[model samples]
Target chain A: MTRLRFAPIPAGLPATVPFTGPETLERRRGVPFVARLGANENGFGPSPKAVEAMARACAEAWKYGDPDNHDLREALAAHHRVAPENIMVGEGIDGLLGVLVRLTVAQGDVVVTSDGAYPTFNFHVAGFGGLLHKVPYRDDAEDPQALTAAARDVGARLVYLANPDNPMGSWHSGALIEAALDELSADSLLVLDEAYAEFAPDDAIPQIDPEDDRVIRFRTFSKAYGLAGARIGYAIGPAKLIAGFDRIRNHFGVNRTAQIGALAALQDNDWLEQTRRNVGAARERISAIAQDNGLTALPSATNFVTIDCGANGDFARKVLAGLSDLGIFARMPGTAPMDRCIRISCGPEAEMAAFAEALPIALAKAREV
Target chain B: MTRLRFAPIPAGLPATVPFTGPETLERRRGVPFVARLGANENGFGPSPKAVEAMARACAEAWKYGDPDNHDLREALAAHHRVAPENIMVGEGIDGLLGVLVRLTVAQGDVVVTSDGAYPTFNFHVAGFGGLLHKVPYRDDAEDPQALTAAARDVGARLVYLANPDNPMGSWHSGALIEAALDELSADSLLVLDEAYAEFAPDDAIPQIDPEDDRVIRFRTFSKAYGLAGARIGYAIGPAKLIAGFDRIRNHFGVNRTAQIGALAALQDNDWLEQTRRNVGAARERISAIAQDNGLTALPSATNFVTIDCGANGDFARKVLAGLSDLGIFARMPGTAPMDRCIRISCGPEAEMAAFAEALPIALAKAREV
Candidate 1:
């Protein structure tokens, strides 16, 4: 047998998927989930204008997308009130994160992030052989100060902090993020992942200068914009660092339909407002359901609500398994403390109703177990 | 000014785009091309069934694409008569190449390829700090023997060969490719890029063992399948190597619309057959046009035709410029010898007529220059 030669980093790594998609579970279970709330995908759907644009662009699928991503970047520049050079659009935040890690983290380089933060980001860091120094979350939020201190302590190259944190649905005020930046080492670049920013309160959205070389902010259409399947996202940062992406990125990687659809979605402010309203309503409904089932719903600044099952990680796992058995696809944090909670995405009325109906039965089964 | 920390490899590299897309040209020229023949895109377009499926999937753009690409991989496995484990779906051939390079090539790792083969592959190699040793094309064809010799000499970890070669539209028989593999070092993996396989003649189609660990074959829907804008492709290889992709790839990177569209496109064998016929006719038309313009068309087993201008690289470049000025987007090889030819993609009748009309004027302009 011919032995394949893989780089030392990849060879040492296990073939592990960062997250098992809900579809894989469906295949394993032999039944589709009644409410697709896992993966933090927006179930409210994308704008009608965006859908129309994508559907229209289907005939033009033969042409490769603009390698420069010109028009969309220009539109995004106008939307953000920054120069186009400040924005670099990519396949998604996931894709951008991989590139960012590659750009900064060489093998054995130190990096910092919250312990139970985005596994996809961690996956990229590990894939590149970066030495990860994970700081524990503070009170369910991705503590910016902790991340900064860790970066400084480790002499880290990159530090990641996701605002409106995942799995816990908690957030820090923008001022806190800015304050934390002051303590960050000059050599360490802050990777501010604001994927759920559009769904967060204004106080939770940071106002970093576009020219700030110390930081790069990642934003995506997947969350509140409801174009998750389109796979479009952008990173905002100093022009110099943004230009670095062109050095290594697959120039024509972004899908043309995604470019057209994201632009249309960005233009339809009415649709965005309506979706926000829908998400807010769904969050309330989910929280209400959680309270009725004798669980405490965390105060969420993002689209998802994390409900405390009022038990340990094992008990929460049993509850999660029960929910899966009852055809409600949900997820939880991978580590302790936070693992006591189950994360559920905000969806339409029917999905919320389905979750509402299933939660009690799942909780009852978990108690029995 | 704060100095951003980039890894040594990326920091030393200049930010260069591999290719300047035609859209960038259009924006610079302030007009869309009359004949979109550049970028080797299929002007014949995708199957109607694919367009329909994509259109239907537009509403489901809220859900993330299945990370496993389960359905598409199953269909592809059936089509190729291989197990699903042997197939690894990615964003595109370009995206897959990036991952492949990341997996195999570390900094200063030696790699080999034909000098003027796909620039995107070169870009990925350089991006990963791989030391590329270029072997000149033998008689306008990618000399597999030369590539193998160079890989053996340099102790290369990876060797790239685009079958049905790009830019020159040349090809070798499958038997020759199989025979060349015998000389390749066991340590050097052959990166067989069959992006244009659908357009190749039967003799040029290589039949390699699916479990062969010495080579990994890349295939794409962006070519004959007419889904370039969709950005979908797959790599067929030993299950071990295929599984290694899961260690580093963006699990949810492939777009949902692309998955649905490609599956539909694959099922529509009649559309593919029709497309092949269209491309063949266009090749003949393009050849006739070249003959009329006092140029010699190279024998091609691909959708595009490379027309030798019977002059040096400069003359052909001048001719390319003239064609661009005439609202015809065409391309040429970047290196010498092969650069004497101008490449044109197969398009519909109207585009053919436009190219035919513009060639004489462009030639006249080139001669004057």
Candidate 2:
């Protein structure tokens, strides 16, 4: 029998998901996690107003969403103080990143990123046949300077940097990122992912200049806005770069309920502020718990906290597995050195309590191993 | 200033939407559409149970949908009497098409489709730099034999066929499609888009072997299931082709509420039966309306009727403009011969009455033009 032929890129690629979702673990284990914190999802949930709006819009689900995403784009533009053309809404940062890579990264093109950064971006770069050059992280944070230098050295078409970086939960200030941007090669485009921007301190977020052609920043409702399941995010960049997305993106791909709910979520500033306060409290409590367990928690600008396990990667792996066995879902970085720390998302009191109760037991088991 | 460079494919392609959504038209005209009979969306709406499920799921929106889409795929598998491995759920058929094209089509690859078939598929092919070979429709229907012949001639990597064809509302028998499958080149994979399958006669949908490597069929909740805005769909094919999607798809792309709603919608078989009946009645009513206006409605096995304007493409276009002027939203085919027909979606009595009342006026205005 003749086999279906795949393009060389996909044919060479291994079938893998960037992250193993919590549900997959639950299914494999035959039991649901008592505390769900693995994926950096907001535990506080979306605003009541957004929830109400989505519920109300349920009956109208028969109509296709505006392929243009006009209202949402307009709202986002007003919120960000940019022209509507500078903003392109899509099915989350992951989806938008796929389109961006498709637009810029031709086969065997060079791209640069810090080691152990977002795997989905790397997956997209590989899927598009881009050759990725990875620079080591400096002090457990994404080294923007190293990334920019590598881009210059490799003639990189794209460079990815996650602000308030994931896994390690460390961040660089806005001034530092701006300085790094000045050093970026003119030919290299910076892919700034700010999925956790709402959780980051104000100084941690760089000022938006929509006219800048060398950088595209992504923001999402999945984290601070509590709409991860909605799958809505936007990229802010030069109009020309933004326009390039329309040439290849699925125009009607944004779910209508997601668009409407995101709009409502955007409008509810009080809810956002309250959620921020809740996250701040949870972060402090998590740090205190880490200290109580004789572990050091890294300073974080994002919603999650990464704890140094006071041991090696194997010990941390054992700790993570033990936590899963104890019905607490958490994750750690995938690479060495950084993998010595386990990452846990901030949630409400109950989830925090679950984590606190399980940590010592998991650590004990890891020590036994 | 150096300009940001796009890869050659997108650089050469025009930034255009395949279909101009009705919302775009409404924004331009500053008037809401009174009858949305365009886009072939199911006006009867999703099951109330599905709507309620979505509404309930809105609170849990902070969690990412299971990237595996395990439960829904399992349900779809059971419903179809196939194994879960045969099904791959995605954002929509539009999204799945984009992924499929990316996986199969490389630069300058050959693809075959009917001249006036779904433009989104064509857009994807062009976006991927595929050389498309278009075969003309025969008797207002997609010519399967011609498509297979063209595929063989061109050594096409992909051949696209929309069963219960769009715009013309025509279909071939399952037996006929099975027969045509015999003639399809071994090297070519058939993309059988059965998005309108629920409304199609049972025989119009071919029996699923789940082992056939030459064909992959796409079905959607967007049409008869009435969840177009929710943007959920699935493809059933050989496990190898189905597994290939995991290598490149956005694992977390499917919205959580959409997955939940689709599952609920699938379980409500009674609602689907009612919707089919409603569509059957609407088809009759639309044909009757066409006769009243001295137009001819093509025989339909789907949720829409394609009305022959009894003139050329120009006349049909003018009639479409007239309908737009009367606050009725309708669409027509984009190519010659097929372009002489205007397609209308089935809706409730209110929208139907609006279209019924506007047809003659639109016809008169069209004649004036």
Residue A90, candidate 1: alpha-carbon lDDT: 98
Q: After superposition, how far is residue A55 of candidate 1 from its true place, in Å?
A: 0.4
Query: How many clashes show up per model?
Result: 0, 0
Question: Per-residue lDDT tens digits of candidate 2, residues B178-268?
Answer: 8778889988999999998888888998875988888999999999889999999999999889999999999999999999999999999
Which pairs clash inside model 1? none
For each candidate, what is the lDDT? 0.92, 0.93
True contacts kept of each: 0.87, 0.87
**Compared with the true structure, what per-residue lDDT tens digits does model 2 show for residues A93-127?**
99999999999988989999989999999999999
Over 4 Å off in model 2, which ranges? Answer: A1-3, B1-3
lDDT of 1 at A150: 80
Model 1 bad stretches (over 4 Å)? A1-3, B1-3
